[model samples]
Target: MDEVQVVVAHSERATLRVGDVFLKVDADQARIDIEVEAMALAPVPTPEVLWRKPPVLAIAAVPGTTLGRLGGPSTGSPAAWAAAGAAIRKLHDAPLPRLSGRAGRDVDALAVELDAECEVLVASGLLPAELVTRNRQVAEAALRPWAPAFTHGDLQIAHVFVDGDEVTGVIDWSEAGRGDALYDLATFTLGHEEHLDDVLAGYGSDADVDPEVIHAWWSLRSLLAVRWLTEHGFDPFLPGCEVDVLRSRM
Candidate 1:
């Protein structure tokens, strides 16, 4: 019998692994539609879709370790990071998928959410008001218009998989859609800024991206995730973790 591994479980969705297959269960049918569509449109490697049955989608596991973890050092070589970068570049360069989910997310709306979350962080006394304020100000740089691309809306380090120097697959596509290109880059390197250079090197010089915007996203994402992580029974405040990321920006 294959052991069932709980990859992730939250109020909104859950992912389970059994043997070589992954079962993603989501209550939102729209999100599943977007994931299936985005995976088909992506030019880079994504997990093979085995089947879909309404609330559950089954996919064959890609044979490779994740590129890195959120609060830890990446064991991936610079080349692997570069390959992942190249893969992102390919995805960003592809035609934008027509999806109502998270595509064309409003920057003003993001700023509003950031502000609300920062208030929660401060009122809870979980983080210093000064730290939250500074990051919030830094996040202002990302609150501008951007040319939409096929962004992996949540491109965390753990979502990218690699074998040796080759990127085998990218997972967790529920947030995939047309959005800001820099958002993807920032999400990929959040808390792992040290590897940004190698990733950018592989991404090449075609993109005219602003470095400040990328930095802003780091602050914004950390601030937003910290509260949700805490609520979901994951401690983002641990040392060398999401809270640490917010502090590092100070």
Candidate 2:
């Protein structure tokens, strides 16, 4: 198999084709299919580098022009954001369920996982016990009614691609999981209030997701990321996005 040539590789397990029908490992194994296709939201091109928009599987191409991912996590422009917002509205119309974590492990539970994560951070001396407590509160608050859809586990500007008012692609699906849709939505929308509102408004009156739940999830999302960063030896600086979220919500 010849190596799959591209400017970037989304998964660590990504390999290049060396000969006819040969698979080589430059890194770890890729569990990409289950990870990204579990909850699809949009159409994806074949030989896809981005699967965050699953349900529209993109299989290997016959080879000709570039067929990998096009959007990026950091480079999506405002029009791209707008395009993404439109797509999100359409996706949210799906009949997804609410999370019941700490409640049970049935694909929608997030409470126990969040609690355990924060506790581990505290026990490891990475985060203050107070912060852990704050994280828990935020988590609890975020656990509310919001419709499910094909979600991007860690949806953000970095995962979106836009060209004018069109959404080119949705990248990254490693963290993809089932739960309230806003769990992903808030990560990208809340940070930019106006855009966030635009996204919400785009959903119109038909969407089942609750506004407060989205905000709560935004708070919880920040705490979760902060806790992870702290556990990984990052500083908990004041005025930081994480801190601001926790302080305001918790």
Candidate 3:
């Protein structure tokens, strides 16, 4: 029997890889429902659903490696990054899902949540107060209204798969929902800002994009994710990582 490889193990969910199959064990049924439905509605490439039982979703692994890893540099070529951007553009252009359970983030709630999270970081002494303050101010630009599109709420580079210059698939649809189109673009290039031009070029001339807002989301996401990553036993303080992302805002 092939050994089961733990891809990621967190309290809310876990992913295991055994041979060519990836098993997702999620305690939250609502999130699972959203993932399955979102994958079905998505027009781009995604992992093949093998079967589903309550709390466990099995999918055939897609070929190729992730576009990049968090807390690390990306080896993906400019063309591959652009391919990812094109895929996101296609996803944003697709018709919105009719399902009522589309997940999203509200700016007003985000403000309150950011305040509370910053307090936690400050009180815990996990980060310098000035670092948190500057990022918060930088993040405010993304708090404005945006026309919702079918967005992969957590469109990290690691979620995108690529073979050479072609994007083979995108995984983790749990956070997929109606949200800002630029949020996806911003999320993909969070740690890899140099690739933003290639991505935008691939995304083409359909919609206007705000560079400031993209940068804002970068600061906001890094600030908000630092604590979550640490709690989950992941390091956000690695060199040129989430912490650096916040500091770069200063």
Q: Candidate 3, residues 55-161: lDDT per residue as tens digits?
A: 99999998999877766767877888888888889999999775457656788999999889999999999999999989989999999988889988889888999
**Local error of candidate 3 at residue 32 (angstroms):** 0.9
What TM-score do all the candidates reach, one by one?
Answer: 0.96, 0.60, 0.96
Could you tell which candidate, 2 or 3, scores higher by lDDT?
3
- Name model 3 segments beyond 4 Å from true: none
- Scored by CA lDDT, what does every candidate get? 0.89, 0.51, 0.89
Pairs that collide in candidate 3 are none
lDDT of 2: 0.51
Off by over 4 Å in 2: 1-30, 35-41, 44-80, 94-109, 144-147, 175-178, 230-241
Cα lDDT over the full model 3: 0.89
**Model 1 residue 203 lDDT score:** 88
The stretch of ten residues in a row with the least summed lDDT in candidate 1 is: 99-108
Q: What is the total number of backbone clashes in candidate 2? A: 19
